[model samples]
Structures are given as structure tokens and as C-alpha cells.
Target: MPTWDNVPKGQMTAAVLTNPGYSADPSDCFTYSTDYPRPTLPSPEWVLCRVHAAGLNRAELRGRTGAAPFIGEFIIFQKEYREEPPKILGEEFVGEVVEAGSASGFTEGEKVTGFLNGGGKAYDGAYAEFSLSHRRRLYRLPATTKLPWNVLAAVPMSMYTAWGALNLAAGLGERRKKDNKPVVVLIHGATSSVGVWGLLVAKDAGATVIATTRNTEKIEKLKAAGADHVVLEDDIDTEVLKIAPDGVDIVVELVGPDHIARCANLCARRGTAVLVGPLNKNWSAGKFEPFYIPPTRNVSFFTMTNSGPGSEDADVDHPTVEALLSDVVHKIETGVYPQEVVVDKTFALRDIGKAHQYCEENRAVGKVVVTVP
Candidate 1:
């Protein structure tokens, strides 16, 4: 068998999702499948990449737990386009292009990073030795990018997500007259991967940012991540009000449904509240009566759905995935964003169980990336 990097031409190693149960065990979730076939170039716009390192996302647990924000619909999509059994599990990856179809606009051997498509099977991700992505979605790294591939691996999904949520929901690039004014902003779940990048984007847009985190240890980290003010979760309301008595102009809510109401209520008149994840173990929000808010002081809610049409554009009220990726890459190239990648830890692909366990526990200060040797 022809091999490159120890992976056979037609076959590769992958962490197959053998059990799709929402159980409390990590080891019981993934199993090594050596005979997993490498994906063929699907179209002229597709590129086959050799995986270098794949970053773990909170969304990665959706399949195992069946508790995603869109798990039901994702399952339906998978059942419709079902292919391989067991399924490949992963999302964002940094890799070297092994085969770029003639129309892909990518060159062989170029280092690139981006996220997997949204439709089809949810598990056709970057957890394998080889994976596929579209040229329109992939971002080629800048020649001046000095970050290691392991660190750069963590940027694509999180950055795109953060940028989308902030720009789309919070109006980062909106053409309002108030756009030039420094608005008071609150970032919930301020230390999570998306939260950190959101903080940076908000700061760059000249908003005065107030960040919230339950972990006191992350306060300094959040500040370092460009948060102007950091508050513990319990102090969110009081502290945020103290900083912006009338309420914040925008709230980047990553903490999910449990605290969304409170965060929304904290928005100033016509202010925006955006949700990026459901990190608090609750995905669904229960119905409740409307809280008394001023007629002028109403808040609008938006969810960060990073897929489907116009998912890549920043219209007045939405963000395009492609635009955000390009912005983040350019910022990294110019050293405007932080050069250091906040990797809490790295795990060999073989030790994936331990990696999943760590992410499950939510003990990491930054991202947990799995490296492919």
C-alpha cells in the first residue's frame, strides 16, 4: 500500500464514534479504527488535507451526549446522507494540503486551516489522518504567521465563531451612527475559547468590555485576553450594572440558556444579546413571562449558527464565515492579535480519552488540541 506519514493511501487512522449515547463516560465513546478509509476529493472545489493537529471543541461532545443546540436536526441530516458507520468525530483542524483539486484554489503542501461543512454527517470532522474541506471555507495561513501548527490549529473554529457571533449579533461592523461611539459590552463565559476571541474582537471594535467567568483563576487570563473589566459569575448583574448603569449596549452570551434572560435584561434600549453556546449543561430554554423592560430599552436575541446560507457574511445583522476567517488570519499576520496560543494542554491522538476527560471536566484555561503524529 502506498503510504505517506505512515497512513496508507486509501486508508487512515481515525477515532470512530462507536457509541452515540449521552453517557457519563469518555473512554466508552471513541474507539481506534485503523481501517477507516480516507475521503476522496468530492468535487473540483474540494481539497484533501493531511491532518496535523485538531482542536477539541465543546461541540465535539454533541454526538456522544446527544445534547447539542442542534443535535436533533443534525441527526436528521446525518440519517439522510448516511455513509460510513461509526462516524468520524472532530471539527476544526490545521493541516497540510495533500491534494487540491484543479479548481480548489489551494496548492499542494500549503498549510491551511478551517472548519468542516455543516450538512451531511456531523461526524465527518478532522479527527482522522485525512479529511476534506471546501476551498471557499478554508483559510490559507499567512507566510508571516509565526505560530506553530499546534497552536494555529485552535484558531479556525473558535475565531470564526467568535467573530460571527460578535459581528453578526452585536453589530461589530454595523454602520450605525453609534458605531464610532465606545459602547459598554458584557461578555458572558469570558474565559472560554470563543469568549476570549470575542473579547479581542470587541476590544478591537473600541467597545468597553466587561467579562464574566465563574472561575476566579481566569480573571487575569480574561484581562490578558483584552477584557477591560472581569467579574465573577455571581457578581455579573451588580458589577455589570456598576460599570454601565443603564445596561450594556451588547451582551455576548456564551453561558447559554440558563443566564440568557438575565443577560438580555442587562441590555440597554435596542441593545443586542447573542448566544454562542450552551455551556451550563442546559441546551433548551423554558418559556417564561416577559421581564419588565423599558419601551425603549428592549433587547434583541440572536444565536451563533455557524452554518448554512449567509453564515459567512457580515450583513448589518449577520456574519459571513469567510470574512471572519480572513480578518482573524490578517490580524494574526500583522501581530495585532495576541501572538501566543492559549493551549491548556496537548494530547497525542492515542490519548484521546484523557483529552476528552479533561474537556469534559472543564478544567482547562484555554483550548485542548489533539496532535496527530
Candidate 2:
């Protein structure tokens, strides 16, 4: 157990999702309250963090609209919340540890950022002034770091997903090492946060990147983010072939399953296509045939939340995640990674609905963040 001697109060402000269904108005999804009970340490390995900022993701929108079947079938049951409890919804946060259990491997007042099993029964999410997380899911920020809380919060989930999908799931790093030539990568939905990060990461790894967007206006923006070639969504196949005649070595698919067949067709022989996002909100591939992709090409899926503690599918453990995060921080500090391209906007926690609306409307060029001041 941990002592709460430093805690200012037992209650804290939180944005709770009392309703979990689709609504035209985003504000209808949450019931914000200042008297929401602050969570305590679940065990000695857990720590209580004073949240400074939280990142907004499409997953939360799916959670709100009962579109995330993986979360649970219970999400669609309104009657259950009346009997049980309505959980908070958020996945990534940057905060200071206020109460550290003896076995948590952390001391009080340390700044950390990482993913949480948000909205799950075991632990509440980061939509509160305070949240609880196991030590394994967190990365301690250096005392000398100068990054803002919102920027730090935005990096974890997007960066982790992009890095994991490309390197681990799609084997971009290994492919780069093996191939004497520069590996070619295609990032579909290149304007999304994950797509933006994927473009940066692939460019940083010395890969020739071809990025795609629905709007032609964002083509310049993608190029500015280090894309060697930018193609409109409709012209992706034609334009990509013009750039890489042999097809791309890796495809980071952020547009969802609707484009899986097309993306797979664009892959080079023995290349990999990793689906990392569901931006279209369409879960079904709609008559997608497995035989459409030849045995020579591969299709894979990646979920950033799978790496949280206790997940059997997690390939990279805590220490590896921490090291990657540390490298990202160094890149941000040294201006290698442009901070402006990482976070597009910030909203106060009270205005979370507006933030959600902005993100869902696709107005943000990068990540949308909610600050918990």
C-alpha cells in the first residue's frame, strides 16, 4: 500500500462517460464532475499520478459510440451503468507521481508518461486530475527535459503505435538492415497523428517514404514532415508505382481495413503491410478475400495498448519501451523531431467535448491534447 499524506483531497475533477453511445454532439458522451472520487493505488506495484495532460485518440471515440467491440459488449448496455459504475475514458497521460507504492520503482514527484488500460475495470483512465498506473506502463522523464506536458502526452501512444507497427510488426528496421538499398515505405492516411509519426520515423531510419492523404492541400504538409513522395488517396496506386516501380517494402496502413486489399497490392514481393488504425471507423473489410494477398506478401495488425502490463501478446517489454521513449525525448530536445508537428492543438479538460469534435472532424494535422489543469 502507499501513503497519501501528500494528496490534497480525496475527491478530484474527472470527465466520466456516463453514456457510451453515438451522438451528434460530443459533449453528450461525458458527465464532468469535480467531486469524482480520486483513485487509490490498486496494489504495491501501482502509483497514483497527478495528471497534467492526456491525449485524445480515435479509440476513445470508438469507446464512446460503442464501436469498440474489443473493449466489451457491455459498453452498449445503458442499464448496466445504472447498476454498476460509469468509467472514465483515456489511454495516454503525462503526469507527476504523487503517491508511489513501495514496490512501484518510483519516488514521489517524478514526471512520467505512458499508456494505461484506460476505461477498463481494473483501473480507471486518465480523464481525471489523478489516475493510477502500474510502474511497468510508465517511463520517467529526465529532470533536465524541457518538453511541455501536452506534447509529452501526445507522443506515447502515437509514437509507440507507429514504431511498433513499422519495426516490430512490419519488420521495417530488420528489412532496412538486410537490404543494401534504402527501404521504401508507404504511409496511408499520412495526415493522421500515427501516419505523421510513421513518416517521421521511417524518414529517420533512412527509408524512402511515400505518404498519402485524401486532400491535396495536405500534400505539402506531408512533404514538410519528410515524405519523399506525396499522393492523393485516389491516386495512391498510380503515384506510388511512379515513385517505387518495384512497390514499397512496407505499408503502414492507418486508414483501416477498407483499404487493406489495395494496400497489400501495393506491397513489394515479401513485403509487409501493417494495419495500425481505424480512421474510417469501418471495422469490416467488406468482402476482403485472404487470397487477394499472395503468400509472398504479408498483412499484420498492431495495437499499442497490447504492450501494457500482463498482456501475453506484448513483444516489447517495459525496458525496451522506456529506451525508445528516451530516444524520442532526446530527439525532441535536440530539434531532430519537430515538436510543432507532434501536437496540433490543446484544450482544457473542461472542453474535452470540443477537443473530441475537432479530432473527429479531422481538423487537426497532428495530435489533439486535453490538459488537466
Best by lDDT: 2
TM-score of each: 0.81, 0.88
Candidate 2 local lDDT, 1-373, one digit each (tens) = 1223323348999988888787888888888899988877756887889999999877677766765434321222212222222367787799999999899899998988857653333346788898887776767876677888988987988888899889989887787444567999999888888988898899999998998888877778787888898888888878899898888899999988888899888998999999876799777788999999878999998874433235643554667777888899899888888988888899999988888889888887778899997
Model 1 spans with C-alpha error above 4 angstroms = 1-9, 22-25, 66-86, 118-123, 175-181, 289-327, 333-335, 339-341
Worst 10 residues of 1 by lDDT: 311-320
**What are the clash counts of all predictions, listed in order?**
6, 0
| Residue 54 shift from truth in candidate 2, angstroms | 0.7
